[model samples]
Structure formats: C-alpha cells, structure tokens
Target: MSKLFDLGLMVRTYRDPLAWLTLFVDLLPIIAIVFFGWKAIPLVALYWLENLVIGAWTLMRMLGTIAGNILNLPIMLFLGPFFCVHYGMFCFGHGIFLQAMSGNDQGGAFGGGPVALVEWALGTAPHMIWFVAAIAAVNGVFYLVDFLILGGYRKTQPIAEMFSPYGRIVTLHVAIILGAGLMMAFGQPLLGVLLLLFLRVVFGMALNMMRRLKLDGGLPKTLDPFADMQVETG
Candidate 1:
C-alpha cells in the first residue's frame, strides 16, 4: 500500500552514487532490447535467466543454513562456499548455452550446427569467465550498499540477510516478464520496457522500506521471526 510507494524513501535510497550505478546497470538490458530489437532477446533472456537460477540457488542455501542452525547441525558452515562456487559455475554454463543458441540462430559467422556451436562456445568460454567475474563484482557493490550502507545485516541473521537479494531478483524478473507479455500483446514493446523499469524502481523502494524497518527494529512482530531466534542463539 502506502508503504510500497514512499517517495521519500526512494529518494533517500538512491542518493548514493553506488545505488545510481547499480540502477544504471540494471537498465542496460532494457536499453539493449529497445535498441537492438529481437537480436538482443537471447542475451536479455540469458542475463535474467542466470539471475533467476542463481537466486533460486541462493535461496536454497539460505533455507538450508537456517534449518541447520535451528536443528543445531554443523553442515551449514560447509555449505556456504560450496553453494557460492556452484552458483558461479551455473552462471558460466548458462552463458555458454546462450552463446551457442544465439550463434546457431544467427547462422552467419557462427554458422548453424553442432561444430560451429562447439567452436563458438570454446572461443567464448574465456570471455564468459570475465563476464561471470563482472557480474560478481557488480553484485559485490550491491551487497555493500544493502548490508553496510542500508544496515540490512543489523536487522536479521546472515542467512536471512543473504535471502534479500535473491528475493529481489525473483520479484523483479516476474515483474519484467508480466510487463513484457502485456506490452507484446498490445504490440508496444517499448512501453513494456518502460513498465518493467518502473516496476523495478517501485519494488526496489518497497524492499528498502522493509530493510529500514528491520534495521530500526520496527518490523511487525509476526514478520520478525528471526528476532527471537537471534536472541536464543546469541
């Protein structure tokens, strides 16, 4: 409701240069789609699909860690790094897959066949490493803004705090999909991209409000399950 559209909060949230840079990065895919037409669809699909997959992976790890802690198990400690590495590999794999698919579809320099696809994938594999690293680097900045600047960690356990970005990714992806579908149905792809961007900003503001409430210890009782858990564990 009103909490989701707090303009004041939105203004304050994006005041930082890092926040603005993150938003700019988020807008790049939409820009590509608008300028490059359908040729950019595969790349855009790859980008968001990677986010969705990694988000799901992160969510699983967070839930696993939370459950392990609740049950007094030690396995969660070992899972942290394992899940991170697995997520990185998953991103790289998707990057290669997208490259192969796009190359075959284009059928020019890449040609259309298994061998061409294999060659393209091999040649691009090293670049995919850099691509994955760049994604991690951007996400690192987001983590810093969310946790340190916004004080997200002050409001919840590390596992729960880690869940926030994944939650945002899933929500933003759904918004973009729905918005794009409606726009395409009406033959208004540009409008749809604009809608996607608007929804992202709205959702981003809502998330910031939630985080602020948590940091201030003002979150509703029912929504604050980890508060008591922290007290018990500490």
Candidate 2:
C-alpha cells in the first residue's frame, strides 16, 4: 500500500489521455460558470442530466461486455432489467429532490415523471444543453475509442461495468452536499461552485484511477492512483 502513495505514480495520471479527456469534460462547466454566470442550481441540473447519460451508456457497456464474453449473457439478462428499474427510480427520486431544493413557493418535488425532470432541468438554464451535449459526446468518444476500438470490453466484466457509474455519481453527490452546506453557511454561491468543481475533478480522477489499478492486476503490475471512495472490486 505504501507504494500506492508514491508521488510519481500519482503524477502519471497526467500522462493518461483518457483521463485528460475526462478531466476536460468535467471542467468545461467552469467556463460556463465563470464567463456565462452559471449558478449552482443549473450546475446541479447539468449533473442530473449527466447521470442519465451515464446510465444510458452503462447499459451499452454491459451489452458490449456481453458481446465480448458469452458467459456474461445469463447474468446480464437477469441483472439488466433490475439495474434499469432500480437506477431509473434512483434518478427519478433524486431529480425530484433536486427540483424541490431549487423550487420556489409553488412547491417542491411536484414532478409527474421523467419528462418533467427533463423540463425542469432545461427550464432552469437551456444553455446547459451544450454542456450536457459535450459530456455526452465525450462519453461517446470513450465508448467508441477506448471501450470498442481498444477492446476495453474484452478485459472487463459485466458486473464491474454495471457498478461503474456509481463511483462517480456518489463522489459528485457527496461533493455537492458538502458544497451546498458550505454555501448555505457562507451564503457564497461562487465559492461553493468553485469548491464543488474542484472536488468533483479530483474525486473523479481518483476513482477512475482506483478502478484502473484494481482490475486485472492493476497496481500490482504497475504503480497507480487512488480515490476517496475506492470502487476497486479486485
């Protein structure tokens, strides 16, 4: 474990192109927040939409994993629908909570369904679609270039792919909650937003690194990185 703390191993994250792409996608919102005057509410909406996209692509990853390994079929058949229903409700409930938080005297959590969620998100700041699109496009690039072209699916299991999005999701949610607390206490939205973004980027990269190091003799084969919530199954 001491070797895992090595500075060189951590700094090597800078050399990872995929990691850099992830960072780029994660940080683009800063530009929006700084130059375009984005607030925490719209940023929250952005992340909510990003969660949906991640869920969508995770399903694709599971399919790709199944395609690579026929043995994953049976479990995929059972777990696939279960994951959909569970993750959908999870997002739906979270969306309601978010709408409530940002809602006015009209009331909170008054949404009918997913359509309402999307409407609420876009209603806050329509321009966020561009950020959302950038996120989706970047994720698609990873799906195509890393997972497909590089045969990442060949190395990973369906179970790992299924749990993949949760690490980032949990990390961001925790950061948001902390940032929200800080903002509420200080009444400083800008400070909250900056801290939130910083935490998100650091934690996101760390989680991905932990994952990379865990699978297929990751850090044992080579020195690697870490995260607050280590989603490393291996």
TM-score of each: 0.51, 0.84
Model 2 lDDT tens row, 61-85: 8878876889989989987897898
- Judging by lDDT against the true structure, name the best candidate: 2
**Error in Å for residue 134 of model 2:** 1.0
Estimate candidate 2's alpha-carbon lDDT, on a 0 to 1 scale. 0.72
Candidate 2: the clashing residue pairs are none
lDDT per model vs. reference: 0.47, 0.72
lDDT of 1: 0.47
Count of backbone collisions in candidate 1: 0
> How large is the C-alpha RMSD of every model relative to the true structure?
8.4, 3.6
